[model samples]
Target: MEVKKVDFRNKIRHQRIMKNTSAEFTYSFPVIRGIQAGREYYTTMCPLKLVPRLFKFVEDDLPPDLRAQRTLNKQRIPALARYIIDNKESYAFSSLTVSIDGEVHFEPTDSDPIKSKLGVLSIPMESRFLINDGQHRRAAIEEALQECPELADETISVVFFVDAGLNRSQQMFADLNRYAVRTTRSLGILYDHRDPLAQLARTLADTVPVFAGMTEKEKTTISNRSRKLFTLSSIYQATKQLLRKGKNDKISNQEKKLAFEFWKEISNNIPDWNLCKQKKVAAYELRSDYVHAHGIALSALAIAGSALIATYPASWKKNLKAIKALDWSRHNKTIWEGRALIAGRLSKAKTNVTLTSNLLKQTLSIPLDPSEEEIEMHYAAGKK
Candidate 1:
């Protein structure tokens, strides 16, 4: 036989363990694997006196009756009874999970301490409160426990987690929301100015000749048409949306150029500027038939583009080429010259026209009084 001397402190520790032999031990340490240079080991430990006693013990006293569970309280109170009946199993009772300081703690009650001191709970159990799965089963459990306050402090199955640099909780939240059904309409207006789609629209706007080379006069002309520029912008936005495909089906630079070309044709040819004033009825007919009916009132950009392609079934390329070849400046120049010539005739008819050749040689500041020739000559110049 061998004999050994033991310290008094060690003796006291052994006495305490022996005194509470039936008391369950739940380890309060993280179950983690560690490598030390060449060897790997798994470690776990239980902290003594961690969970306080005096927490109440609770039990159903009798196993639940699966038959009495179906006993009804319907008829007189219909809706409430149906809800209870439909969700009976969930209302019966279920467990909850909670954490304190990143470590899971359950009240020290009658339940046996978990034998396996790691990972998640697989066995069915009950807890006082739930932590994460808020709306699913927790509401029912809370309702049941409200009538049975004696189970308030009852210890339940708990799984603990470490607080040090862990991301499992955040990842779990993301995964849950990721698979949730959602509506795209709720995303609001499609073109956020900061988004890539807006950049594409701006690029197309820059490439369209009517927009790119817009003079104040030309802008005024389009502005006078009420919804001209608006129609063009709508068409561009809609086309992009209709053509968009999968995440990988990105709009190429060339495709953006093509969209620009299509827009130029829509803007230039829609009104048929050459015959607009002469054939006013014809011009309005074309506008109503093509521009107003087909081009106006597009709320979404992608839809407008789709509408254009649908309306012009044959040779969109040919229409674009015709619009490109049409000349706007020559008719404008003719109008300008005709207006000047008319003004000259009207003034000349009012008074005789003449010019003194020497008047051109005089300095502007001379202030010389003019004879009939000078007055006639100034009038003959006719406000150039």
Candidate 2:
């Protein structure tokens, strides 16, 4: 049954709703009627309404006329389509940047689990393309947006800073990231250096491109390692902590400078650093020695050797030549170009002990005979 037109201006003589809440009713009114000529009143035609009970059967309740059905169908489709179309823009913009609110909007893709979430909180507040964080997230967002324009409206949340600040960058990064179940490149950008722990990381990053050039993916790799704290971060922290603990000890300025210089000399001389340069030792072996021998022992050895070389260049000339040759093997244009394909694996695994030590021993091994007692003493004294 069609809904008959109702006149808005009709005045009812009386109106009342049923006292029982369960009772439903519709009001009836008169349709407009013609007026009579020569002062005569006219009565309106009867109007009728169907109560709720009349809507029980579908076929009977609906209008019998096909024209009415067609009009309703036309109106419904366009309304539904418009709602869907308008949402497309908002979803598309989510790809633009990680926003300040820490809510990330990621584009939907087949590979991602349906509930994957993105964004960072308490991160730096910069709007620039991330130099150090969220590589995979960025890549996924960029790729998705490129493929689906509708997803460009998505946004990612992040805290960002332009430069490393007051040595707090790395620590701050760690603090914000300690609970992050998933790792991202943004962690690399947060390396700050105030505390001794962070200072070591800063120093290492300064010395090595692997740390400095770290993408978001590398941060994940670094985080999973047990030796992470003992690395650059550990060394720097230990030095800082020792200094702070001794602040009242009336240490001389010259002594302090020499102490730090000594510390750096030891850090740079670690077997792993040598591995990065593809020296006589391999990375893993160096790591093993570092673990077993203690940092202080190796540090003292490095300091002693460096001091000896500085004072008696003639005596250490062969050692200097060996150092130069190793450095040359690492970056020499002629050697790199000629052997890149053959040595690419070795070069990338620059710190691999088995690979690097074997290569070095085969190529340029030198013999050194230190007494076992001296080695033992160094080991005993060097536990840091």
Candidate 3:
């Protein structure tokens, strides 16, 4: 749907003071009509082309800094703009809240609903609008408009609220974000198909022995009765370690097969994992009693497997069986303490990861490098 420009003569301009049970104040705003996704909304729709000209972000040079919204994050704008430019056809955006401090007029329409009035909001040409929310979106739209001039006619909704002052604007920002919930990493990985790592993690969970029917697909932490020991995100990170793949590196079929085999071999070496799979040992018991049942240990095992594969590629599987002989019980203080555990509590710190991996390398008869040896010695001395 195309949004036609409003005629100045038909635009209504009037103002009325509104009163409520607790407070009475004047609200002056203009209602804009625009077409998007084959539907029309009465909310203000600022053209992508006009975003840069109409919105002013907080800057050091702007006078009265406190009145401005939060500082613009230049780094995050490009990625969002790229999404708009790439998916302009299907992209959807929520409305933005804007504030104007100068004088405005609101004229009610004849078809206005009861207890509510419709009007055309008008502000002087000299007046500027401040963004209380959606600054990043505004910046992204501005950038997207530059690369895609065809988007100039595309409309985005904007809500106009009468500017009370700096305090109210700050409160608006806080209120807008107060109840917002962020998606968990495991859930994001579980649902996302665009990321190759997420795809591989899901595949591993379904195909690998230890992960099959034993991985948490959505939540990061398992509940007491969850029946799962590892999270999808943890498997994703540990697989990245095993494969030595960077964030953006593409995975080939061969690499996927290798990862499947690597995890399968590790699972065979851990007896408790098999017992849990067979229903002989409860998932909760393994999780609570074994070091190998947690993400930290899985990641450390991946690190050790990477080293083993690099040093003993031809016989890595045979050597991985050594893990079965080692004491994996969380209560094995002599080995787990100061390595996977600190003061009888699990620690996921880099130092602990390094110490734990070094121990795995030694168990597999894979010689640790000088640095790994040094870290192991430090932990050993600390334990004494």
Candidate 4:
């Protein structure tokens, strides 16, 4: 055994053995030991800088059957990296789980019951580490470090488990992901404070008289019998289009005020929406008959509303009032068949959104741009 002082710069991952022995040398971590299904496991904090040096990505080029983790989606790395870089102060990361295949040593601090649970874990340099989960996060961290090297000192928690062979590692990967459930988009909008559009949507749902108590805050889609009429994600997308903003564009105070005033005007003009808000009509009745109750129509209306503001900034509201004259019933399939409905089902496909927006723009007396005109030409040709 080699004798060396504890170093924080070692490029090593960890594992543990249950032998009653002392750790004399090699990569070490002050860890808390725990048990799972009658087996030993250790948890430790790892510095951001050493993370890239150790825990090398299991090459995706390796066959799926031979590897313990999925191939990393390289496209996702940029967005995740941007999230970390943009929200350095408030970002939260969960612990990473890894399996180690080598002998390890554990040294308890002292004799007390609580101290017995705490110890330093040591593993050799020749050991291999396999990620059971969080490969995306690891890749994101490496990418973030390239732009902001000062984050090297920050630490992330990692959970280490011991098992031999690729078979055990593969099983660990499967078990970690077996029960995971993704968060709903509406819930994401509800809890997200980092997204300006999400904040705008949540505030509209809470403060807008017509929307309060009439919006679904948990699910992206509203059920047939649900008392709610609109969804939070729909509000986010509609408001985004209403302001003519891209997915990640920054919004100013002026733009936010415009969004608020526009929605308020829309609320005052739509009798069907207001009727549902007042409980004068069942949600199902309005939803079944109206185009305005669905995301497709809301997005399309916002798209046209954007053009209306640009075309006649002084008279957009007067032009918007013309929507009350235009038929909004699902039964008006003659006009909406190819635009909003495909085979009697509402469709939110890209072409459908543009087509529906074209009709609304014409109703508002706003001219379509060149691209929209091209789409209109294509749709008109398909009619024959």
User: Candidate 2 at 357: error in angstroms?
Assistant: 27
lDDT of 1: 0.33
Tens digit of lDDT per residue, candidate 1, span 1-384?
222222222211111112233432223223333343343223332121211221111222434331111122223234333333444444232222222222333222233445333322111112221132222233332333444444343323323322222144344334545686643321211233334444555555456554442212122123334433333334343554545532224577766665666556555554453334333444334333332222221222233333334545465545333433322222233322222124322111211211211121121111223563466456446545
Query: Model 2: residues >4 Å from true position, as ranges?
Result: 1-190, 193-201, 204-230, 245-260, 267-276, 289-384
The number of the candidate with the highest lDDT is 4
TM-score for all models, in order of appearance:
0.25, 0.23, 0.79, 0.92
Better of 3 and 4 by TM-score: 4
lDDT of 4 at 81: 90
Full-model lDDT, candidate 2: 0.32
The per-residue C-alpha lDDT of model 4 at residue 203 equals 88
For residues 1-384, write the lDDT of model 2, one tens digit per residue.
Answer: 223334434421122224445422233322222222332111222111211111111222445341111112333444333433444443221111111212211222234453222211111112222222333333334334444455433333332332333233334334445675743322432343223334343544454443333212234333332333224423332344334333123445554554455444443534355443443444444333233122332222333344344555455434323333343233343333222212332222222322222222223333223443344344335432
Total backbone clashes of model 2? 45
In terms of TM-score, how similar is model 2 to the real structure? 0.23
Estimate the lDDT of model 4. 0.85
List lDDT for all candidates, in order. 0.33, 0.32, 0.79, 0.85
Which prediction has more favorable lDDT, 1 or 3? 3
Cα error of candidate 2 at position 80, Å: 49
- Candidate 4 residue lDDT tens string, 95-175: 889888889778899889899889888777777887888889998999999999988988889999986688888888889
**Best candidate per TM-score, number?**
4
